[model samples]
Target: MRRTDPEGHGPVRFGPPLPADGLPVLPELSAVLAAAAPLGGSEPVGGGPALLEAACAYWARRGLSAGPERVVAAPGAPSLLLALTAALGGDVLVPRPCAAWWAPYARLLGRPVFHVGTPAECGGVPDPYALLETVRRVRDEGGDPRLLVLSVADDPTATVAPPEAVHEAVEAAVGEGLHVVSDETWRDTVHAPHDTVLIGPAEMLPERVTVVTDLAGALLPPGWPAAVARFPEGEIADDLHARVLDVLTALGARVAAPVAAAAGYALTEPEPVTTRVAATVRLHARVAAAAHAAVVPSGALARPPRAGRHLYVDLGPLRTALGAHGVGDAQDLEEFLTARLGLPAPGGHRFGDDLGALRVRLSTGSLLAGTDTELEECLSSPSPVELPYTQRALITVKSVFDDLRDDAQRWEPPR
Candidate 1:
């Protein structure tokens, strides 16, 4: 019953799909793009207030003190983060196994990024005790620790910080006077509404935090670039916002007039698109649940996912059995699954997990398609019997474990 790895013919998608909702609405300046089509004619300057205002309103509605002036629109979150790192110009701290972009973002700017281990329950926010120690260790090494960037509802692990955990992390940062940048790119895709608390980081520490979000993750039709960072209140925030605008101007990072119109519309009216995104969340929960059920001991290595749209399966317990299958580590397991089960999950190495440890992220979103019709159908179906792709994925993963158990028995010495 040895599981044979399935060969991958092309790219396998297992992440949130950008909603295919129609073009966003922009009533006032619909003529901006057509008129400025010639190498930037008028283009409506000042970073587009309607766009920023919409972003601010969205955040404020979420209980964040995101004033319109504090809203800084950029092409996307990564660019704005790079600019902020440059302007702040000090030591930055991030949790280990973060999104692949964080390391490169720091490397490109020649900024040092210190990685601290997160709690076993989550992956984005660092363990509070470790946070304190890391801060001391960094400053002791002669680097001024000024900012802490955390991704609530993290990308790789797909876990969200509990409200109390969020408060705890911020309290530690406050003690050290650290400015916090919370990336909420995946906030809209939480698997369970009540399981995740959507309090912006600014709510936890207003004067010390900035929340960065973009239409890239949850909203449908993300071709256009438009993102907003809700900065802290006060003169410092005013200065930072101005600096962001200056950098955007220098880099020509304005969200095109058409995209801004669309993004503004989406930000203001997100119910329809959000309903579309929820389908992915439901799919993740179902697939994860099936995988958990398939485990021989049911919870031996698989823990229930707390939030987000992915599952982090630990293989430490099955290491010896997996080794005999020629899967020695996370990479081997990833390859085995992709080749045999037709799953293309990223290995632990991608997220800074221990190389030798057997842990990999399983994104259940592979069931998604580019079309709204398919997405709509997936959303409406509840029972695994309804969606064939999602059901097949669950079965394939379950087959892996069934093979693992059978293989263990075969490898055992005769009694």
Candidate 2:
């Protein structure tokens, strides 16, 4: 029952997990690099013409009508978000327990942030009723809450916002005249392709929404930073697009020529790229489900993952037991898990959740370990978790939970 030392010799360093590598590299990358066509001049601030066309085509595939003129590309989603916030200057409203980076970016821009709690079914968008309430409250306090940021298919919680929730939140935000920024980076990574019911705010209220997507999430290789934004059509969209470009140009932020070419090709949704994305979706879903199952027996509550590479775990049910071991808050729980399991599970507080909540975001990407060939083989197998590399990772995760639960049952705090 003694606490394990995270830095001790026996601890397992689960990760700091990188994004999975089972997806195939785009074949167009070689040709694009060889041609070296885009390297000569600076791309337009919004994006180069070829990249914009590909982005338009990408959105078209998703059932949203877009033109090349409406698309803007940036080095990555975060940079795009920074530019967007600066361009649409105002206080930001985000769901409590949102992607870890959202509030931080708002703070960096010196904008006040209001965190509204999410609905029970999802983690990205705020609860519909709560959204209006938070906005009113912030405005009453003399704050200009003009921007609402969200992810339709969320990251830390790994759940997609249901269609009804999306509609209600959008209706509420639009009513308040708050411009919406929907980060749809993980929309393509849904585990069950048929189960995806994402109705982006852009589709629901196009004129009021700006859609941002990170290609690195599903298509491009890790470290290849590229993302695109689809602004709503018309004069307002044009103005925002211009402002975003001006900011990007000032920052000297442009996606590299070779990377832009690779991005353009992937955005075309080539068959190979789509197939690889499907494989990743399947692999991550299975691994995350296994991780979820492993922790549940220890009294951890987790939503079954629907997309992306994370699982949000709440140890509140085990609070009494955890508290006996001096793990009373989110920070304590995070440190305890890291020490015992060597897992880099960040506490919910980092994502704007209450510090006292016993929640942590668990990244499941480490489960896809081994060389690319081995990972690709695992992805192809009917039972991926049974493969040696994956199985070992799952087993380690389960064993940690088992040990924690066993220790919890045996330990008693001194009166």
Candidate 3:
């Protein structure tokens, strides 16, 4: 339990392993890195003009207008979030099941993180009524609730919060005087971008929200850690932006020179980077759907993944079968499923869900690895589900859960 945090080891906590994508770097991106690798120095404390401008352009394309001065870049989202948490001091309220990496940074700042229950429609934003109730309850309990971190396109659950839901949450947080930090890292990875109405919190509360996006979420490889945040324009926001830059400077969290160049290139939406991300998201979406299909018939419950490379499921219905195998809580379920499926099945507790809940998040990347042909087929094929490797992966998920269903039936007592 005392082991280093899986997301940010600096601030130690029990975090689930971040999903690993084994795909090779894109050729165009590789060319960019190869070209930039020879010219070396750290970027400026808050990012150089080129990178900042590139980020501004990226945000503008997403319909949130901002200048280069309002954006800040860090080596990774965790470091950036750590700086943000330090700059804005107060207790944090996160949704019940959020990205596993969000809380440690708050804890690193010695801020208590409270989990508000989320609406059934999505995993990231808190239920509006629950949000209001929790804020008042925390104040009554002597907590200074000031920051609320949320995601529009979430990890684990892979649900994209609807625009109306986002508006309600923003209204509640702003009404409560809490600055919202919207983690829009998955915005570009929506399985159906045109159909899904992705709204950033900054769009809802212009002067009271900060937008953060990790390049690794879609635009760049995970090894090249780069993330950018956009602070809304206003006098108070300007001062807060300065504080964040100072914190970044103090922590020496500047982006590496080559990575900054690559991130800049990726953010500009060149055809190569755009195509690769679209293809990858498509592959993951199909695989996630297959996994969801396999589990549901066996009594496991999951929302259809709308974005990202993972799906969250509740296996509480199969708890009777799992209990027979000494898998009682979330951790036990995690260990059992990871070993059985030969993949990382991070328990729900890793994302702030209750310890007693039998739930886990399964990464599509875990099942997407194989021979070059198989991997290529997965990336480019119209029906990846027809491929042998893809079918085998789904079969494995179905077989395990189907067996559990049988076990549950066997253990049931006569009525």
Candidate 4:
């Protein structure tokens, strides 16, 4: 998992495929643990009252109003998603090129999954028109597409859906009677708070939408693995909440007591946590922008990252040049980059993109490689990306694209 850039060429990651350097360690975490009561001998079927109350306050800050009774917690968002998929008991509609875990989780629960293309602006919510068509096509073929999962602030593509688009997509899904799971894990990670617009489906269609938040992404440390869901007030919501708890109970799943204590404190968004989150967002945006600048003019097609820690790269433009080197598809592209540039990125095929698309998800997180003290300095620095450590990572990324572009320009097809 550790691939050295060789001669300080770039950064390397060895953990869960997320930005590692900027992982914030909350100062309050230890105090929260110290104050927490000993774990009871029995596990709670769902999130305890304290955690649920904190979750409600977290959502309220973003304009969604809910009480603790409507909130349910799980070990993490993925676990909650699994329980929800099983409880809902029908086909699932997901965006083409979504978070890597969604499709696989649905399959594990034995639910059929259909993909709808995303709007040009983002990768989480499906394209409104395509969503309706896909739903109809599935139902016509006797596949009951009953759930639509999306992220208002998306992953892989790193673009936030416009408020208008969120409204349209939710309207379409609700009109078709699909229960929507809106993943807002990255909502608090918006790079530019003022420039980005995020409207959760729960805000628009509370009756039919369940908002899932992963605290690890924006608040807590990634290793903690805590998440909560806000359900709309209704009999169906009540029943689904109970079913999810039952499933979690069967699986012997519960967020660790200490982690749950941290979650409660983090969800309240204390000033220190907010400051750290904002700093992390700014760091990612700068590094990703630097990487984007290097890739776009070099014949790769990529959307300028607007939020989160990634950029979606399409290498179709270099197909001829790549094909000359036996790199004509997504898998080939992934291997070629890792072998040639010492960079490792997940191919689009893993996210339900076409195998031949030559697309890859590039994470800027690795740009944050260094000791904790160095990373903290980078976060606090007004020009973090300009620091030697961070600058070298960016330069290495730019150099890879520069070489690729040169090769493409000089390449001549074989007879």
Question: Which candidate number would show the highest lDDT if scored against the true structure?
Answer: 3
Distance (Å) between predicted and true CA of 359, model 4?
Answer: 1.1
lDDT, candidate 3, 211-253, per-residue tens: 9999888998889999999999889899889999989999999
Question: Candidate 1 — which pairs collide?
Answer: 5-339, 5-340, 6-339, 6-340, 14-366, 19-220, 19-221, 97-351
Q: How well does candidate 2 score on lDDT at residue 187?
A: 87
Report lDDT per candidate.
Answer: 0.67, 0.80, 0.87, 0.80
Score candidate 2 by lDDT: 0.80
Candidate 2 local lDDT, 173-267, one digit each (tens):
99999999999988888888796777888989999999999887888876778899999988988999889888898888888787788888888
TM-score of 2: 0.91
Model 4 steric clash pairs: none
lDDT by residue for model 1 over 299-359, one digit each (tens)?
2375566555566677776766788989876668778767876756666655556567677
**Where does candidate 3 clash, by residue pair?**
none
Candidate 1 stretches greater than 4 Å from native = 1-46, 221-224, 278-280, 291-300, 369-372, 408-415
| Residue 263 alpha-carbon offset, candidate 3, angstroms | 0.5
Winner of 1 and 2 under lDDT: 2
TM agreement with the true structure for every prediction: 0.82, 0.91, 0.95, 0.92
Question: Can you tell me which runs of candidate 2 are displaced by over 4 Å?
Answer: 1-42, 411-415
Superior by TM-score: candidate 1 or candidate 2: 2
